[model samples]
Target chain A: MSHKIKGGCQCGAVRYSTDAEPMVTFNCHCTHCQQASGAPFTTAVAVQRENMTISGDVIEHTQTSDLGTLVHRFSCAKCGAYVYGISDGFGATAVNAVTLDDASWVEPQMEVYVSSAQPWTHMDPALPKFDKLPPMEES
Target chain B: MSKKIEGGCLCGAVRYESDAEPLFAVNCHCRHCQMTSGSTHIPGIGLPAAAFSHTGDVTWYKIQNDRGGQSMRAFCPTCGTPIMGQIEGEEILFLHVITLDDPGGFAPQMDIFESSAQPWDRFDDTLPRFAKMPPMGE
Candidate 1:
């Protein structure tokens, strides 16, 4: 069994625990991620829904991802720091690894959608990357 | 009247103060901003760097900006709040408007990078508009 990952909102009002290890960790360079993260990319860790436990009142904001998938953004109602995102079309959800209690275990696997990546954004040269969404079967 | 705005990282390890009002406000419709804010538009309040004061260590995530220059994003490592953004050549710091005492006071002056905007999106047409960032010098 994978070690449990725990984290919560900035205000500590909402807490979540996951028993399943993240299947994929990616840094997304899409413009939406830039605008939302206010940075060049958003680093996320994906895990199966059944392996996670979430608590506290969360406010959800929905958006259509570049892939035409519905991504539900979950934030703490009290503190407002965006916490997690779950896609409706898939059985997996991506958590903000930065918020995890023990995020060291989840290493970033790749950087996605580099075509829209800001020119100055830099990454470690060794990591694998793709210009657009990676095929689901390959990811 | 100069006022001091005080905010800190989630763990209170980093603190900052901004005395000047933003030169402008903006709402980014790009996917990056969308992922960060978890919203339709990520609004920012831009203030000249000279008017801002800060204390404590802020870890920055450097990114390439649209203008082919480097941009620095300072955030609280403890709390993870995106505190501000700074461009290599510009004197301004794009502070997260949401950190303001009266967040509503900072509103967008224009909409930029709209060429990548979504199809179902609709915004007020009365505001100043630009298909992408205004021709550099404008």
Candidate 2:
């Protein structure tokens, strides 16, 4: 049940699309993601970089992830809306699910970095939770 | 002494300091918040405009409500992290809670704009929920 996924920045300065199925969708409660997104957690739809097509100029800001891996964040320069992230910790590009044209279909498989999650943030208990990133095979 | 509430963007380019205590904490599930933050919702704290000070080059995006009210969202140009938002005609400005140096101890009173919330987005059932913006000025 895969469909074309599309989305863009709030200001319409950037846009992206992909027909490839997402590798995995999960929530990231890492402090870096929290600060980067201004949300309690970031829902990431991991996809292959080669299958994704992006238009418009994106500002890349590289920083150290909570995992101590170098993560490259790409966002719209005009609106500062995050588009996707590339990090050494994962093999696929982590696309911000909320940025999708219709994010209602986003279903997270797990919640990571629960140790850094805020007390006010309520999550679905049915999903598996981890204090930090689990082994790639286990994730 | 308690810790000071101060923070900046992911790249440490945009910095802010708030000396006052939190006035209100809320989680907005509006579509705009989702698109801007690239997350399910935005958890922010409202503070007196006078007490909060910030420094850095910020990229501002303006959104107009159906009632003609305007809201301004500020993000860091260097790091692309949203840090602040200002509502027109309002005395207090809202800051993203996660922007705080210590982004803990935040307790949101309610959820607003649940009408547009994504299905996969979860919430605390204990908190009050509103389909859209609640009536202001009691």
How well is each residue in A40-129 modelled by candidate 2, as lDDT tens digits? 899999887677788888888888766666888888887778778886666567888878877767789999999989887889999999
Winning model by DockQ: 2
Superposition TM-score, candidate 2 onto the true structure: 0.92
Please state the error at residue B16 of candidate 1 in Å. Answer: 20
Model 2 chain A: weakest 10-residue lDDT segment is A130-139
Specify the poorest-scoring 10-residue window by lDDT in model 1 chain A: A31-40
- Cα deviation of A10, candidate 2, in Å: 1.3
Quantify how close model 2 is to the true structure by its C-alpha RMSD in Å. 2.2
TM-score each candidate.
0.53, 0.92
After superposing candidate 2 on the true structure, give the runs of residues whose Cα lies further than 4 Å from its correct spot.
A66-68, A137-139, B1-3
List TM-scores of chain B, every candidate: 0.77, 0.92
**Tens digit per residue, CA lDDT, model 2, B1-138:** 135779898888889997888788889988778877889899998889999888888888788865689878899988889887887877888889888887777888999999988888898998999999877884
